[model samples]
Target: MDNHPTTFPPAEEDPAYLVFLDSLDYLPSDDVARIKAAYAYAAKAHAHQKRMSGEPYITHPLAVAGAIVEWQMDADAVCAALLHDVMEDAGACKHELAEKFGKPVAELVDGLSKLDKMEFASYQEAQAENFRKMLMAMARDLRVVLIKLADRHHNVQTMSAMRPDKRRRIAYETLEIYAPIALRLGLNKLYRELQDISFRLIYPHRAEVLAKALRAARGNRKELLTRILENIRGKLEHAGLRAEVFGREKSLYSIFRKMQEKRLSFSQVLDIYGFRVVVENVPTCYLALGALHALYKPVPGKFKDYVAIPKANGYQSLHTTLIGPYGTPVEVQIRTREMHNVAQEGVAAHWLYKDGNESSAELQIKTHKWLQSLLEMQTSDSAEFFENVKIDLFPDEVYVFTPKGKIMAMPRGATVVDFAYAVHTDVGNHCSSARINHELAPLRTELRNGDLVEIITAQNAQPNPVWLSYVKTGRARSKIRHHLRTMQNEESARLGERMLRQELLSLGVVPISIPAAAWDSLVKASGQKSLDEVYTDIGLGKRLPSVVARRLLAREDMAGDAGSNMTLAIHGTEGMAIQLAHCCQPIPGDPIIGSIKKGSGLVIHTHDCPVIRKSRSTDPQKWIDVEWEPEEGKLFDIRIRVEVKNTRGVLAQVAAAIAEAGSNIEHVAMDADPERLMTSLRFTIQVAHRTHLAAVMRGLRHIPEVARIHRERGGEA
Candidate 1:
């Protein structure tokens, strides 16, 4: 039914596999024996299973392991890759693998197992948890991730066997997570291939169109490639430099993204063909760059020297784009043989360490420090591990020069604060300012690759809360929030304790009698911690004073008429000289009454005070009618208002006179005025009694700038 060639043998066929093994230079040895053992075990375990494509189940694992072998990985990784799916798919157990092989191999196999038995409420939750566990496994050992990537690569490559909708979902996840990780680890070739495969699956129709267009244009670009290669090779030869020039065509995914993002047609995409110039040394890399520029006009901002400033993933290459034959844009890359090995193999080069003879220990460690960071940040649960993994391994990077001209690569949009944190946590904690390109800017300022950043720190300063909004690295953000949250919790607990202790003391209760056992239970019942926690809750508005008092009273066996307890005595006459509750303003001339509320003690109010009217019907026993006694020199703070001409010194003069008249100003506000050049000011003041209030009002009346002054009479219900 398909139009493509039917003769293309399936990957699992003996002929195809022979070619794969030959390409890897696989030979008969102990390692080969171990691989054979794993293959036999996997073949038996998956004997009854069949793929959606009607292939035997062992074919999938073989394909996955085949991808690993393409990277020329170690024998253990290849064996682990072959058996990775056995535990998850079949009834195979870890003990069997351990007995057959060793614990390390068994552990590797177990780490790759997916959570298949548990039922999740939603596919999203299951996916998240599964990904989380996979990342944790990768943190424990990088080989797990390498094998997983290989598995994903093979699955994507053979996605035609899957339903269209399933293919799209898997493709999206690959683009969002897998491809970025590949690039983050400096596996550029693998990264591009995975992206292209996913793209073909997710958008088959569009992919076909692009493919056809690329095919049609291939002939047009052929001569351009030959000419450019010839020109570059000729120059290197003339310069007495040993160089190998090869044409590098852009992948389908790269072409598709460029066309879409730049809104260009296939023919408009001129930078599709590039050349990679492999040299013998770093000095020759620069020399080749000069030769290429002299042959063609170099694009101003298209040149990047990653060799001098290697990427975070240890990618070292000199890159540049120039106007080539017939005005076509062509990209050129230059690197040494060592750089090429690191570029192609990435962390897989670490396997040379196990081979027992590595030339540079420091270089190997330097190349893998980022991998170690991923392992370090992997300290969280599976879900968090993947979340942090995606962040820490993001491939999009910005290269910046240090104050000493040393280059450092960080995530794109990484700010000065991120740089500071990257330098050291202590430096980040105390960072106060930064100068990018020698110009003072905010600490959250995004840093450019070549920009020289000067970090300014102070011992007394700590990270600002605002930095969370701009920091790009997960480590910096996590550390900043962790520090701030800890500080806030401690401060809040301290304040809460102080407030609780004060309220308890007012009751003539020495809280010392409360046993630790009883206190812990009471605190839990109150939804808090120690006494300080109770107070902190009070200060934070989580708990009210009256609520705690009521709960404490119930626990203390003190139900003495609620309000008429010894701590708070109601009127002796049961009616005269009632005290007004300052919570709501109540003037002396206003009709007032008293109420006995639980825990809050005696709460007096104006006769028509809204509080009494609202609670009057709920509990009559608690509301006791009382009368205010005249001539009781009880000072009450009340809010009043005064108007004066808008002037700068008017506030100072008013405050001075109030102080001079023996009245305390509790609160004040000046409202804006446009006409009459007058401003209205509200003042809450404390006076000895109504007579003192009148005296205070009379003193304010003599000020010539005062237009009017009046007490805000109590409200009527």
Candidate 2:
């Protein structure tokens, strides 16, 4: 063997960058010039700053801004992208930025800045609050959200430099918050990329395992993917259709998610890769799909024509999974160029809405409507803003149709009541009848897609408290609760005033009229907004009337002699007495009697309690005189046991019976021996009083398969 001198290859030179001027190939002259100037300003501002990975920090911001440009973002978003981190890392204030760029740009930068001065006990709490702040800011301006997403996308791309734990936390946050918002905004491409990148970091072992499997499987599909692409191109050409066909593999994260969701293992999973066909028009999308089905057996129920029914996020494509020549499942997606752009960039494509330049107006219109709802939902208290936004961010939506073909998206498991409220508060409060697909349906019926819903209204049909259990949408749930609470307060105040008057008469003390000034002072001292609020608090059990009376008496004594002990005790029932009841679980209703049990000051019991039954026969001296008084509605707990054969729908059947009987269940616990095929269920229900309790028990007893039903008091039959 001839041994020659070993030669080493010279190191490869770094890849040359396309100049900014060259990269502005398609951008308008004026727009390109503006961006070039912004680039220079940002470069100088970030000259000394460096990233954790040792790259100039300007590289990161520029990368983010470049992504924005790819999305065809407007001038404002571009500027915001360039300066997203200046305030956070450079110790610059919003005012300085405003002086340099403009108020809008500075505000966007401020919105992206975190409250770094404040210390958090845990990273989780800081992360949560930071996320809340981001969402709140996004609600105010659409550009803030777009730029933030861009920043997040680039950060994820370079996440390997961070510690594993930090990477995991960041990935989890991106998946939970950023990805969902992007999906909600119709940015499917960004959403998928974020999710896939996050998934890889969070589960590296699984990612590697899947990657290995994909490599092994690729050989089997390489020839197939190529043959399928060629066949599709030939067919499209034969049909006088111009199209571009490319092979597409399912992302590792996506395959992992599908397996997790469907409870399948690696081998059980199919449709590992597919092809995407981009055509010139909408009609061609359909025609290409037909050509595909002719070549392969289309999988039933795996076909979706989103072009006709685009998702709320504005994604439109023809998706079909087909069984190929060897019975392998292959997914194919068809879309036109415009649809493809929207599919990838989502609302970001709105940058092309104007003449030769779609401004971000279309995106602003869609996202702004949602953001406005967030603002409109602001409670009087700022403490509830973050809580409310959290509720709104949970976007498991169900798409329902109106009678006129309009699509409305509401939360999943939403009832007709939720639908009514989603339309308008007036519609919800006055809703009397609902027809889904032109047939009368119960208001609590769960809505499904493609169901044409029509609401029938009565002028006086105010929302009933019963609807709260069935309504799933937060808007409807909140509105109904608010209305009911208002009504309850008004009635409680009126009743409280009457009770106070009676007490004054029984005490042999004439009601003292408060001077206007004194009454106002009393109201203020009681921490009530109005006299009505004071009385309502007393009636609603939030305050004690006797306590208020004692305060008033002390004030009166300071002013003048109000009464003597004899006068104050004119009646035999001297001291203030209030007690909870046992039988019928009397709460604000039913005849109540005060009984002085030994050691217990005053034990109130419902007139029908078994204890009262025995007390009347023995030791009547312990019972004090008492009667029903006007009060507000309150919660009462009563238990019932149902013995039934454990059939397929026995639990559901009994629950439906009780619900129809109008008794609300506070809680339910059930026990059963599966082998014995029998079950005993205990339910703590809320009822108005004795009459309602009896009616509810009778209804449960009537349920089929209910072998027995009995009322119990603290486990006593």
Candidate 3:
């Protein structure tokens, strides 16, 4: 899929290369020559190209490589960053690069390349497919994403010369996709920068207005902020605590988001300025927190110990709000020096602190786990996969506990089903309900921090389609959807196999009697990868069974309708592939016929149902004889028209009769003829089979207010 550009640009020296050479101290002395070679290669490959800023193309890579250098990446990452765009935009191939540099560097560059060779239906489709490739490669080597973030950072900072619409579109993507990805990886510095620049580009007017307001507010609060910072530093020193206390201002974009989320004016959004106390060790972090609290009265219910249970992105700090000397609010975060580095740099801190830093290692592990989850959520549709990734890129998180007291950090609004999937996919699939803090709760219950959750699962339980509506985490939704899709495909395959077998029987043949070579030939001829694909196509009505039957049998057998008498058996649990007609509401005991409906697969109708009877004669091959397997403990919905005396308590009485007869009224509608003194109540009730319907009808007839009752089975074709 890699489209190697054939026209290589001629090499020419540029001043930007000299500046980039100075930032390579992070690379080993032996690998420095290789990095320079990569730079020269990319420089020549893009010698004639220029950015919208009119800078030589190689400077873009230099800036991206500079950012990764700030994160302290290795030699290969440096080389890969230098040549990241060469394979996509310049004349280069992965094999040549791999032979020249190394496979690792070449693969990194390959991962960063866009899928420009493919045609997509929309811009979103193209972006999603490219991201899908990049994400998959990221799961293999995390440096790919690091280089990508650095690349995105540079692009976002240099997009002023682009058209307004393109600028807004890229800004939207940077904010929605890349910014969250940065935060998800714990790259706080890059995340905030990307969000702020994107917010400016997307809403220029709002950004400038907010910037002006912030400038005014900053001047007014300058003296107060200095005083507070000095007070915290003095107290920490007085308490024998070694700490670096600094004032931190919220980013303009973060302020804007807070205003929008909370619906507040700029003046109403307080706590824009905060403080951070970086200490020598973990114990000193708490000591500094205590010292800061001693300096000012702590605000009530305004403390969070993220260090105890880190956020989903592996962010850890002791955050607290205090009443300052002037009676205004001051927010402070306490953390160790290593925690601060990891907080700002995120996964890149792994390589920075590769010398056995426990906090950095933990963050690396958590990030890899999240990346693996993203990889596991493989969907056929690239856009859908992108959506699932967005779902996982949650900004807020809540920490909860399992029944065994183990902590699990989930998205803020995640429900019990999300928690279950977070535990394991099988657990989510089999989850029936949950116990929250020793009390029974529904599956859709939104979890709270510190609540002990115990998933109640059943062996035979399956994921309900309704779970997709409320489950917050993409892991749960994707797992449930994957299971349901597999189930439907399997059901369709089974039904298609049966249909094919029945057709074969009419031609005096059995499926097993067909040779393996014959089936393989048929599969190949049908242009399907395997026999299951052929069957799935036939079962879904995308391919006609009669046509397939003719292909599998001799020409002499096609002269008669011998196999037309064969009936296909229907299982009650043929989910998604088999639809019971809404008009007839056929139960297990009802005489049923199957109609192949385009897009819907197959619909089962009662034998005498008016909806399919006309279609049955007009299109004879569309209808097939089907018999029910009569599954136990399965409920079927049936509609009944009940004529009742026009009375106040008559509706309640009819409902009670249905309930007494062991049926549930799913829905009820009334049609009143006031002058005739009679009312028609249409009730949709669930029953086990036709006999259960008979019992409900008999119970309703026994009611004194009931004049007539009969099953309702009328619909248009």
Query: Which regions of candidate 1 deviate over 4 angstroms?
Result: 1-28, 116-125, 349-367, 375-388, 437-440, 492-512, 516-717
- Tell how far residue 254 is off in model 1, in angstroms: 1.3
Model 1, residue 170: distance off in Å is 1.2
Q: Can you give the TM-score per candidate against the true fold? A: 0.72, 0.72, 0.90
**TM-score: model 2 vs. ground truth:** 0.72
Q: Which ten residues in a row have the lowest lDDT in candidate 3?
A: 1-10
Q: Which candidate is the best by TM-score?
A: 3
| Model 1, span 62-173: residue lDDT tens | 8888878877777778878878988888878888778776677788888888888989777766776777677667767778888988888888887788889999999999
Q: How much is 398 displaced in model 1, in angstroms?
A: 3.0
Candidate 3: stretches off by over 4 Å: 1-15, 237-240, 270-272, 325-327, 353-355, 505-518, 554-566, 571-573, 589-591, 607-621, 627-634, 645-682, 714-717
Candidate 3, lDDT over the whole model: 0.86
Task: Write candidate 2's Cα lDDT for 15-111 as tens digits.
Answer: 2113434555667776655555555566666778788789877778778877777766666667678778878887778886776566877788888
Better of 2 and 3 by lDDT: 3
Cα misplacement distance, residue 297 of candidate 2 (Å) = 3.0
Q: Pick the candidate with the highest lDDT.
A: 3
| Consecutive 10-residue window with the lowest summed lDDT within model 2 | 566-575
